[model samples]
Target: MREEYRGEKGTTTTGFDLGRVMWVRKEPSHDGLIVPKAEYEQEREEYKGWIAKEIELRGVPGQLHFKFVRDTMRMNTDGVLMVVDSSDYAMIGDASAILAETIASFGNIPMEVIANKQDRNDAASPQEVASWLGVESATGTCAKDHESAKNALIRLLKKLE
Candidate 1:
C-alpha cells in the first residue's frame, strides 16, 4: 500500500480510488480453473497459481459518504477486503455492524478480514481480531511493509479462486 509497486502513498481514501497491478504468486497454489482461449484449449497458464493480471483496488469508505457509496457501488465488485485497526479495540463493534451491513447489502460474496497495524505494541493478533469480528480468519498485516500488504491481497485472491 506504500506505493512500492502500485498505488501512490497518500492519506485516507474517502472515495473510490483505483489501483491496477499485476500480482504474481506461486506458493499457496490456486485450486481453481482458468478459462483458456478457444484455440489453446489445453493450455492452463492462467490457473497455474494466483496470477491477477489486473485488479482495481477500491476504498469504499466507512464513514465519509458511506451510505451513498454503499447503496450504489456493487457493480462488478469481485470481493471485499476489510481492514481494521488492530490497536483500536473499541472500533470492533462499529466494524462488526458495518460488516453485517455489508453482507446484508451484498449477499454472500467473497470477503476477507485483515487486522492491520500489526507493528503496534497494543495490536491484536489476527485470530483475536477474527474472534472479535466474528469471522473465521483475519490476515495479519502492516501497511508499511510491501510484502505484508501484498499477502493480504494474495489471501483474498486465493479465496476468490
Candidate 2:
C-alpha cells in the first residue's frame, strides 16, 4: 500500500502507506487506560513516515497555540478525530467547550467524536457521550478490540470522504 510521488513542488519526494496505528491500551482500573512505552515509541516511528510534523497543545493557551500551528503547518487536513474517554464524565464540560471551539474554528469540516473505552463497565454509551458533547453522533470504540477500532475508523473515513 506504499506509494511514492513528487509533491506539488516537483522536486520534493513523498510517500505514504495505508495502515492503522494503535497506540493506547486499556487496563483494568478506574482509569482503565495504559500507554505502553514500547508501543508509543513504535507508533511515533510509524507516524514519522506519514506526518511531516506534530504539535502538542493543552488548555486555553494550547488552544491558541493550535491556531498558530495550523497556520504554520498549512496542511490540507480533511477532517478531525476528537477522541473522548467514555468513562470520564468529569471532563465532559471541558470536552464540550473544546468541541464547540473546534467546530466553530473549522467551519463544517467533517468531525467524529470517538467514545473510546467502550469495554469498561462504567463507560458511557456512544449516544450518551454524543448528547453530552452536543454532537449529532459518536462512535463507540474499545481500543483493545481491533474490530471495534476498525469500525470506528471506517466511520470516520467515510465522513472524511
Candidate 3:
C-alpha cells in the first residue's frame, strides 16, 4: 500500500505488502439504497439519516507532497495504523512529530502504532518506542514476517470494532 520506503536503519527487507494489510470494502449503497458516492455527498431525502455500515481503511501515502490526499482521507478515516521503523533512531523524531500531528487531526479515533523491523538486532523494543511516542503501547512487528504483520493488524481491527 505504501508508495515508498522510509529507508529505516537495520531494515532487512521491506515487504511488498507492508502497508496493505487491511481493506474493508465500502457498504453496498447500490443494494437498492442509494450509491457509494453518498458518503461524499448529501443524503437522499428518502433515507432520513446516514448509517455508516463500515469503515474502509485506505493507505495514505507517506510522501510529504501527498498532504492533500491525507486531508481528504481525514473526513472518512475511522482508525489509523501508523507503522514506525523501530531501528531508525534518526527518524524517530520525525515519526513522533507526525504521530502527534496525526492524533490531533483525528481526535479520539482509534490509532495503532506498529514498531516495525522488530527482527533487527538494533531495533528498539516496541514498549520503549511506545513510551517515547507517549502512547500506552505498541505492537512489535517484522512486516516481512507474515504472521507478525497479520497479528498486529488483527489486534488493531479488533480495537476499531
| Candidate with maximal lDDT | 1
How does candidate 1 fare on TM-score?
0.71
Once all C-alphas are superposed, what RMSD does model 3 give against the true structure?
10.8
Model 2 C-alpha lDDT per residue in residues 1-161, reported as the tens digit of each score: 87776663324333332122332323222211123344555666644433221212111222433666644432455666778889989878767776777776778988778898999999999999999988889989986787776566545555643
Candidate 1 vs candidate 3: the lDDT winner is: 1
Measured against the true structure, the TM-scores of the candidates, in listed sequence, are 0.71, 0.56, 0.63
Each candidate's lDDT (Cα)? 0.73, 0.61, 0.69
Error of 3 at 2 (Å): 28
What C-alpha root-mean-square deviation, in Å, does candidate 2 show against the real structure?
A: 16.3
User: Judged by lDDT against the true structure, how good is candidate 2?
Assistant: 0.61
lDDT of 3 at 10: 62
Please identify model 2 stretches exceeding 4 Å from their true place: 1-74
| lDDT (tens digit, per residue) of candidate 3 on 1-161 | 76776675563444443333222223433222223343334544534444433334466765556668878878866678888889988877878777877877888888889999999999999999998899999999996797776667656656766
lDDT of 3 at 23: 26
Tell me the TM-score of model 3: 0.63
Q: What is the C-alpha RMSD of each candidate to the true structure, in Å?
A: 8.1, 16.3, 10.8
